[model samples]
Target: MKDILSVKARLGLGFGSLFLLVLIISAISIFSLSDANNRFFRYVDGIGKRKELSSELLLAAQQRAVSARNLVLINSSTVRVDEKNIVNNAHRKVGELLRELTASVEAMSPGEERVEAQRLISDIQQIESLYGPVALNIVDLALNGDKDAAVVKINNDCEPLLRKLVEVVTKFIALEEQTSAANVMHSQDEYELQRNQLIAFCLVAAIIALALTLVITRGLDRALGTEPSILSGIAQRIASGDIRAIDEIKTARPGSVLASFGQMQASLSALISEVHNSSNVISGSAQELSAATEQTRMGVSQQRLEIDQVATAIHEMAATVMEVAHNSESAANAAATADQQAQTGGVTAKQAVAQIEHLATEVSNTSQAMLRLKQESEHIEGVLNVIKSVADQTNLLALNAAIEAARAGEAGRGFAVVADEVRNLARHTQGATQEIETLIASLRNISEDAVERMEVCRGLTDKAVLQISDTDVSVTAITTMISNIQEMVRQIATAGEEQSAVAEEISRSVTRVRDISDQSAASSEHTAASSMSLAKLGGTLKQQLERFQI
Candidate 1:
């Protein structure tokens, strides 16, 4: 039965029973007190008072008899008159008492006791009715001065009727005594019975309350298989990875919570021990992996440093090549026109002198540009630092590819791929870094210098004035100069194209490294590793773990 009902059900039943018992006790107490109170009032106001009134009636009747006798014995008229009035007052008192007694009897509950009391009262009334008038008649005879007749009347009529009325009244008093005594006994019995019921019910309530407490406590104990504090301690130990006390819970009752805890602790102990062993092995592997990654990181760092230097050098080389390519293209067009213009006359010769004058102006512009380049060379170191920072980022991203392969949460299957990718990044390191700031600064300075140089180029040089005046003399020299310049332009264009290709390769490698970095971040959540790597990559990462005590 204990097992059949759940804890909630058992508690509800226990409290409900106690509540019902309390209600019943309350009901019984109210009913008994009200009934007892009614009984007390009836005894005091009904039975006891009526009995006293009957006794008074008897005394008053005896007084009337005495007064009538006095009236007969006295000869003075005044004395006779006084006796007559005394007799009348006595009769009135008797009548008043009888009326009260009759009303009381009538009001009493209908029962054998009431009927017996009423019968006795009626007989008293009949005796009083006969004796009262006869005594009055005796008083009247005495008042008329008929002493003999009065005396005769008293002996024959008054004596017998008075005795009968006294006897009937005596019976009524006895009946009232019997009824009063019986009522007292009934009241005693009722009080005793109610008191005993209350005591018994109180005892039962106490016993049942104690029983409920015991039963519910035992049920909870059985359910838990241990104290709540003990169970909590066991749970805490489980969470903290301490299973040494797992055996302690085994003593709990079967099918109880502590028993289940015991089983769970055993399983947990086995699992944690295995995990501990496995973690040890993994620790050694992670150390090895970390070492390999460190080597990779260092290599990437050195490679990026060299790539930064190379890209700087290539940028300068590409700048020189683009300038040469422009010059070559212009020279090629000029060379083609040189032969065609040579077929024309001195007008073409004058044009050649003008071209030489133009060339000298360009040289002057070039010299002015070189001077401004020297001024802006102060900012190149800062730009180079930016390029170095970007190179470091590229290298870190490359290292991330290696890290992603190593810490990819499984066997390091992608390590070789990551290595290949790092090599590819190294090979393509001739490209520019994220040089937006430096490039903008450089462009601004260069544009300012170009504007100034263009202003300088508008003026022809004095050195270019009289030297090439012979049109025929410098024609052959101008054609030969044009051919050489065109060849040099072809070589410069080729170098520029090659450098562009290298920069493109570097861009592709940076893209691959960035992708791998993102993959590493997403998969392993190696935030610390990412943070360390991003130092070179010019970015930052953060790591967080959830907190749980148990």
Candidate 2:
């Protein structure tokens, strides 16, 4: 237990032992006081009380005997009655005293003192029993006016019984005195015994306290490996940051507090020296890192500016491509409109060729009417009128075609001029038909000569029909070529739009790159500032480490 016990445990054990000893001493004192108090009470309630009651019993017996004698002698009735009451009262008092003495004797311990006291009490009671009735009978005899008989009985029975009762009462008194003396001696002896025992225990407690003090003092010295005052001084020095080596620590016991303090001082000195050197290196490295970060920030800033300029140039190029695509789209729409107008002009040329063929048929009828003028000269006049009407209709159709061609814009301008020439030819044909009508009266005399003219007119109408077919073919070819040109223009516009979109995408990518470069530049500035701060903190750490002595 001593091997495992700490300094606190040893101190606690010493204090607890001292407390237990104090408790034992207090208990001994309490027991001694309690015994003395019990002895005093026993004297008062038992032997002492019994002694007083026994003396009273003796006095009552004597008082009753005297009162009984007075009852026989008194002659007045009032005096006799007073004597009788005195006798009864004295007798009753004797009985009360006897009972009280018997109880007190019974309360005593069952030893020789108690046995002798009990024997005396019993004798008093027996003698009182005999004497009490005799005394009372004498009073009765005296109260009845029989004084002679009461005197004779008093001498024969009352005197002898009373003498025996008095003797017992006197012996009981003596026994109570002897018991009271013995009890006083016993109380004194007990008080002396408790006092001696308390003194002896106190001596033992003093010795134990002295021994515990020596043992705890030696154990604490071994645990601390030094004097408490010396150890406190060393701790104060360490707390004040004085880490210098101590000469006394070499003599301290192994595994002791002083030895640990010595080891801690050595380890701390080495650690502080190493930390001081590291702080210098850290400060130099941080300064170099700060310079490098500043250079990186400058490069990032330049890169961001270059990327922004590139993005602006790409945006302008994309706008130019968009304009070119719009122009191509407009050209495609104009080509499509020109193709539709050429197709309409081809349909009008076919109508003009059909009207000329109808004019040729009417001329054929006039030639037949002239060949039969001697028999059908009236039919010749009707045919000439029909040819003039057909020519006027052809002129009107050509004029309508020319108006439509004019409405067809620049693509239809050449077709409009050709329609105007056809209209003028139709008007000339109409004038020729009118001339034939006027010469019809002359042709009835020369109708056989007009047949060759009708054949030449049919040949011209067939040549005009062939020329109109060639015009339709030319119009169809022009329309097809224009349609192909429109498709190519539309494709070119679409390609130009695609190229503009690609340029726009390039511009957006460059914008993102510029944004990223700007962020990088900002980050580089932050890193440079942080490196400078770190260098300052390292210098501060170096200063802090210098405070500890190595």
Candidate 3:
């Protein structure tokens, strides 16, 4: 039973050891790849989850901010209505609504919205501060606590201020919505892409592991059968104190009983012929196995060399990724700066537009004044016409008096000359007044035309100012969007740099595995080919062994 166990153990151990080695190598490969895949999946999931959360938070914050701004606009309009009517009902409604808005905003998480929302809130608070004091004053005046003049002052002062607040709040709402939408879209896209990539990587890795297990098992079975024949021959020769002539044994086919018998006979013949020298063929087979091992070692060395090269490449890739990340961060910062500058520019443009509007208004007033002057000139011209009419009448009266003097003959001669001179003087006065009236009419027409031209210019200036205001708003919105995009890009770049660095490390690792795998594959192919050659040689030896009488 021990002897049977020994024989079975020898055969089983040899086969099992080789099989186990193959399984161990395959397991190592599979495990390493599985670990890498798991890590990648986890990383992707973690990043994606964070991005999704950020997007959700950002959207919520943006919505809250928009809602707050809208409420502010509503509040402003309410205040305006209150001012216009000087009513208790409007005031109470506005106050109630304002309180509700504040409560709603406070209910929402302030931290989620961050500084932009806070800034918008601050703007609203500032407006409220101004409005609150003015509202109280208006209320006091409306209740007859102050003079009617104070109520008029409140109406006059508060309307324009409230209108300005309304405009600002409306703008803030628009900006918040725009940024929020973009951020949400980008984050969703990135998360989906990461999920897909991880899935693909995992699927591919699983397929490769199954293939490696099959090939290794086949090699072990063939090697096991050959071990017993060689061992039996060596054992017999050693026991008999003979030199083993085991050349045919070295060349025998695996699992051939005839070859095993021939190898046993040859060892017995060697024991009888010579005392203690084994055949050189065992050394040759050992040399062949050593050569195969050396080839595998060379393959491993080559694998290591390739791995080093890959590691270098990965290092370079990592560096490049890091640079890209840095550039993205810089770009984001630059965009933020640009956004700030654009906001400033928008403000400047708004001021310029306001100045232009003011200039246009001043021009309109100047044109109106010119028109008034022209009307005054026309009035003067009318007076001059009246004076001309009176002068003409005086000339006619003088002519009639001259005619009367002529009727009195030589006694009226002196009077006639005087009357003629008086008529002439009146005629000259009338002509001069007529000329002055004509000049004044011409001047009045020119002034009217100038006023009309100035009005046209003022209209054009108003249109231009309005256009500039719209453009300023558009530029501000674009700048804000760009700034948000830049910030997102910076975050993406940072993630990309980290991913690239990880990819580089993974690539290096993969390359090392690939190189080792390639070398192992190469050696395995060579080994398979050599095993075939060995099998062929063993067949020849079996044929040769058949000729020997065992």
Which candidate wins on TM-score?
2
* Candidate 1, 1-550: lDDT as tens digits: 3377777888899899889989999898999889898977877689877888988988999999998999887777667788888899999999998898899999887888889988888788777778888998998888877889989999999999988887888887888788878888888888899999899989998999999899889988888887899889888876665666566564788778898988886676675555434433333334434544654565566556656755765676577667766766777777767665465536645665775678677767767766766666655666566557656766876777767765876656676666676666554444433444555577677767777656555444332343335455557766776777667667777777776776776676566556655554454444355344334323111111112121
Which regions in candidate 2 have their CA more than 4 angstroms from the true location?
Answer: 155-160, 274-546
Poorest 10 consecutive residues of model 2 by lDDT?
374-383
What TM value does model 2 have?
0.51
Taking the tens digit of each residue's C-alpha lDDT, what string does model 3 give over 218-242? 4333444456566666656545544
What TM-score, over all chains together, does every model reach?
A: 0.41, 0.51, 0.26
- Clashing residue pairs found in predicted model 2: none
- Clash-forming residue pairs, model 3: 243-277
* Consecutive 10-residue window with the lowest summed lDDT within model 3: 273-282
**Can you write out model 2's per-residue Cα lDDT over 364-448, one digit (the tens) per residue?**
7776766666445565566566676667677776776767676787757667666766767666676767666666657655665
Model 1 scores a C-alpha lDDT of 0.72
Output the better candidate (1/2) by TM-score.
2
- Kindly give the number of clashing pairs for every candidate: 3, 0, 1
Q: Which ten residues in a row have the lowest lDDT in candidate 1?
A: 539-548
